[model samples]
Target: MISIRLNGTEEQFPDGSTLAEVVQHITSATQGIAVAVDAQVIRRTEWASTALRPGAQVDVLTAVQGG
Candidate 1:
């Protein structure tokens, strides 16, 4: 198992889980969501290739319609 900090909370995931998997596991929504690792925004195209590391900070953000 691998440990990661997701959105200020600590969570565990299977080893070799990609960013896309993490995002998919957390939320079911497909669009208007963004992910960042260690304060860097990762493009959608890179999610599949990006792998989570131990102690890495991961943040998931959802967009709101009303301002």
Candidate 2:
């Protein structure tokens, strides 16, 4: 397992995990949220290809619907 700090919290996951797998651990309501790894915003199209490393910091942000 690889250890990572996600949004200020420490967590662990299997090695060679992708951004998509991280998203799955988030709340169901965050399905449409955006993710940034180590300060770089990850495009939606790249989620499947983005591989996270140990000690990486992942920030998951959600879009707020407002007028």
Candidate 3:
């Protein structure tokens, strides 16, 4: 198990989990989502290959349309 900071909150996941897995757990929407790890933005194509390390700072943001 490993602990990571998710959007300012501490969260846990199994060891060796990828960023894609965490993103899936956070939302079902496939578009308008942005993810950053340790303040670095990660591309969608790289999410599956990006591994989450313990005590990592992860931030997830979703875009919203408003008038």
Could you tell me every candidate's TM-score relative to the true structure? 0.90, 0.83, 0.91
On TM-score, who's better, 2 or 3? 3
Relative to the true structure, how large is the alpha-carbon lDDT of every model?
Answer: 0.91, 0.86, 0.93
State the number of backbone clashes in model 3.
Answer: 0
Residue 11 error, candidate 2, Å:
0.3
Model 3 per-residue lDDT tens digits across residues 1-67: 9999989999999999999999898889778999999999999999999999899999989867878
| 1-67 per-residue lDDT for model 1 (tens digits) | 9999999899999999999999998899868889999999999889999999988899889977786
Candidate 3, superposed: residue stretches over 4 Å from native = 65-67
- Model 2 agreement with the true structure over 1-67: per-residue lDDT tens digits: 9999887899999999998788778655546788889999999779889899999999888878888
Evaluate model 1: give its TM-score: 0.90
For candidate 3, the TM-score is 0.91
Question: Candidate 2, 45: how far from true, in Å?
Answer: 0.9
Ranking by lDDT: 3, 1, 2
Candidate 2 segments exceeding 4 Å error: 29-31, 64-67
User: Given candidate 3, what's the lDDT at residue 49?
Assistant: 100
Candidate closer to the true structure by lDDT (higher is better), 1 or 2: 1
Top candidate, metric TM-score: 3
